[model samples]
Structures are given as structure tokens and as C-alpha cells.
Target: MSDFVTPVLLMQTLAAVREAGRIITEAWEKPRSIKYKGPIDLVTETDVAVETFLGKRLREILPEANVLGEEGSPAARPEGTTWIIDPVDGTTNFAHSIPQCGISLALWRNDTVEMGIVYLPAEDELFHAVRGEGAFLNGKEISVTDESDVEHALVATGFPYSIREDIDIVMQNLRAVLMTTQGVRRFGSAATDLAYTACGRFDAYYEIRLKPWDLAAGWLLVEEAGGKVTLYDGVTPFDFGKGILASNGKVHKAVAALITDTDD
Candidate 1:
């Protein structure tokens, strides 16, 4: 892909995402009114409001780009250049007044993610990266760790919402990692976990059955930060709603081997 994206466009897109953060922050100040989209799945008014705000502002920034968001706007898979977004990545955490959730946005040019921005409103943290241009946190550059040993590396992971169907695989992988790594953490937000991995805060992150919006932006961040992201098998390209394995490249192969099921 050519370096067609302009600085003005990135500036405008960041402004829109920050606006979404502002909306989320405003909603956080009030008593949360939570609604259930499934038995354990959640959707909050803040999610809808932020998505709506983002949709409007982003379209203004790129009129030619289509929008695909988690909150039900433009439900179909995007065609051509599009924007993939998750208004609130950790609805359950936010509902409990936990501050681990954030907004995720990425620019998709056909199959490749061209730009990504993940904003945590609670902490005022903004992570963004453009294709081929390295990753950044609040304008400062960032990179993944060089740690090569899984025994000393800190790892992060998440459970699929349909735990009943995937619990066996989840626990098996968790057990393997917990047995070998420095420790493991489940922070409830895939975006944040991936972003943290990009900045060397976490050496790696893995999860299954995640939607595109969950990791779209963060995936770009990790790759641009000198890390690698792939499917669990370690060779396939990770896609929407699939299992993902990301690491600092040093421990990737070793970690993938540990997590993979030989029977499967």
C-alpha cells in the first residue's frame, strides 16, 4: 500500500476518537444503566452513545470510508476502505464501575489495517499507529520487549464469552501458561491487553473467538511496535472473530507451541 494517508487525516481521526473517549468519560460519571445482550454479554448506554458520536465524527473525517461498529451500526463486513470500531471493549468491567475498558478504532483498507487508535478515557492514554510508521503512546514511540524466555515473561489472556463451549480449551491453555510463565492476567479488555503488549507492559497476549473490533486496532499497534501477531497455529493470518496469538517475537514460537493442542 502506498503512503496515502495524510497527517491531517490522522490528526482528524485522533480528534474523533478522543471525542469518543470524552463521551465515555461523561457517561462514567453517572449511575450506569446496564442492559444485557446475552446471558453474560452486556451493552451499556455509553456504548451506544460513544459509537453514535464516533460514527458521525469519523465519517466527517473520511467521507469515502464506510463504518463497521460493534454497537450495531453498519452491521455488514466492510467493503473497500472502512473503519472498524468497538465503542466500549469491556462493557462488563465498565458496568461494575471498573476502569479497564476503552474505545478501539482502526482504518481498514480492504484486508489490511492501515491505521489504528485505541483510547482509554479513564487514564487519558492514546495509542495509535499507522501502517509502516511504528507505534506510539501519547506521541511517544513504543516497542515490545526483547524477553525471549517464557518462564520469565508476563502473559495476558482472555476467555471467550461462550465459556461453556470453549472452557476446556481455555483452561488447558491457561494451565499451560500459568505453569510456565512469570504469571498470567485476565484484564477483561482485549484491546487494552494487546495495547499493553505493544508497549512492552505485557510480553504477550492471546485470546480466541474475538470479533474484529476487539483486536483490529491493537493488532496493528503490536506489529508496528516490533512484535508479531498471528493465529494460534503460528503460521496463518489472524482474521475477524478468530483466535489470536501475539508476542514480542522472541517468545512467540515457544509460547505458541505451549498453547497449541496436539490432539486438535
Candidate 2:
């Protein structure tokens, strides 16, 4: 892909994402009326408000681009360029008063992600990456760690909402990795976990049954940061429905080996 992301466009997009995060943060600090979308799934007023705000701003800035958001998207996936958005990535955590949620946005040209932005309002951290350009966290260039030994690496992971029924498979994979890694953490936010991995805060990250909005932006950030991300089988992991595995390129192969089960 050509360098379609000019510096001005990048700055504008980052500003929009930051503003969206601020909206979420404001609602988070106040009393939020929450409801259930599914058995354990949730939907908050903040999520809808943030998504609406982002969709409007993005359309005004890039009218030619389509939008695919977690809260609401077009009936059919549009052709050419599209924006994937997750207004609040860690809704469960946010509902529980945990400050681990954030907003994730990605621009997809054809089938490839051209740019990504993830903003954490609570921490005032902004992570962004453009195709072929390096990743950054709050204006500082960032890269994955060079730690090659799995036993010496800190790992991060998340459980699928289907954990109620597929607990065995998820636990089995978790157990396998926990035994080999130096430490494991479940922060309940896939975007944040992947962003952290790209910045060397976490050596690796993995998760199952995530949507495109959950991984699209963060995936590009990790790859641009000199890291590697793929499916459990070591293939390119672009399908939003399947799952994802990401690492600092050092323990990627080792981690992939332990979670290669295909049977659901």
C-alpha cells in the first residue's frame, strides 16, 4: 500500500480517537445505566454515545470511507475502504469499575489494515501505527521486546465469552502456557493487551473468539512494532471470527506450538 496516511490525517484521526475516549471516560466517572445484550454480555449508554460520536466525526473527515463498528455497522461489508471501530473494548471491566477499557479504531483499505489507533482514556495513553511506519505510544517510538526465552517472558491472554461452555479447551491452553511462561495476566481487554505487547510492556498475547473490531487496530500496531501476530496454527490471523495469537517475535513460535489445537 502506498503511504496514503499523511501526517495531518494521522494527527486528525488520533485526535478523534482521543476525543472518543474522553467521552467514554466522562461517562465512566459518572453513574452509567447498563443493560444486558446477552447472558453475560453488556451494553452501556457510553458505548453507543461514543460510537455515534466517532462515526459522525470520521464520516465528516473521510466521507469516502465506510464504517464497521461493534455497536452498529452496515448490513453488508462495503467495498474499497472501511473503518473498524470498537467504542469500548473492555465493557465488562468498565462495568465492574475497572479502569482497563479503551477505544480502538482501524482503517482498512481493501482487505488490509492501513492504519490503527487505540486510546486509553484512564491512563491518557495513545497507541497508533500506520502501514510500513513504526508503532508509537504517546509520541514515543515503540517496539516489541527481544526476549527469546519463553520461560523468561511475561504473557497476557483473555478468555472467550463462551468460557461457560468451552472452559475445558480454554483452560487447557491457558494451563499449557502458564506452565512455560514466567507469568500470565488477564486484563479483560484484547486491544489494550495487544497494544501493551507492541510496546514491550507484555512479551506476548493470545485470545480466542474475538471480533474484527477487537483485533484489527491492535494487530497492525503489533506487526509495525517488530512483533509477529497470527493464528494458533502460525498462519496470518486476519479473520475476525476465529481468534488470534501475537508475540514479540521472540517466543511466537514456542507459544504457537502449545496452542495448535484445531478442534472446537
lDDT of 2 at 129: 95
- Which has the greatest lDDT? 1
Q: Please give, for residues 157-255, the per-residue lDDT of candidate 2 as tens digits.
A: 998777798788788889999999998999999999999999999999988888888888999999999999888876666465666889998898888
- Candidate 1, residue 206: Cα displacement in angstroms equals 0.4
Model 2 residue 30 distance off true place after TM-score fit, in angstroms: 1.0
Residues 132-227, model 1: lDDT tens digits: 999999999999999999999999999888888888888999999999999999999999999999999999999888888899999999999999
lDDT at position 57, candidate 1: 90
| Clashing residue pairs for model 2 | none
Worst 10 residues of 2 by lDDT: 73-82
Candidate 1 lDDT:
0.89
* Model 2 regions lying over 4 Å from their true place: 74-79, 261-264
Compute the lDDT for candidate 2.
Answer: 0.87
Best TM-score among the predictions, by candidate number: 1
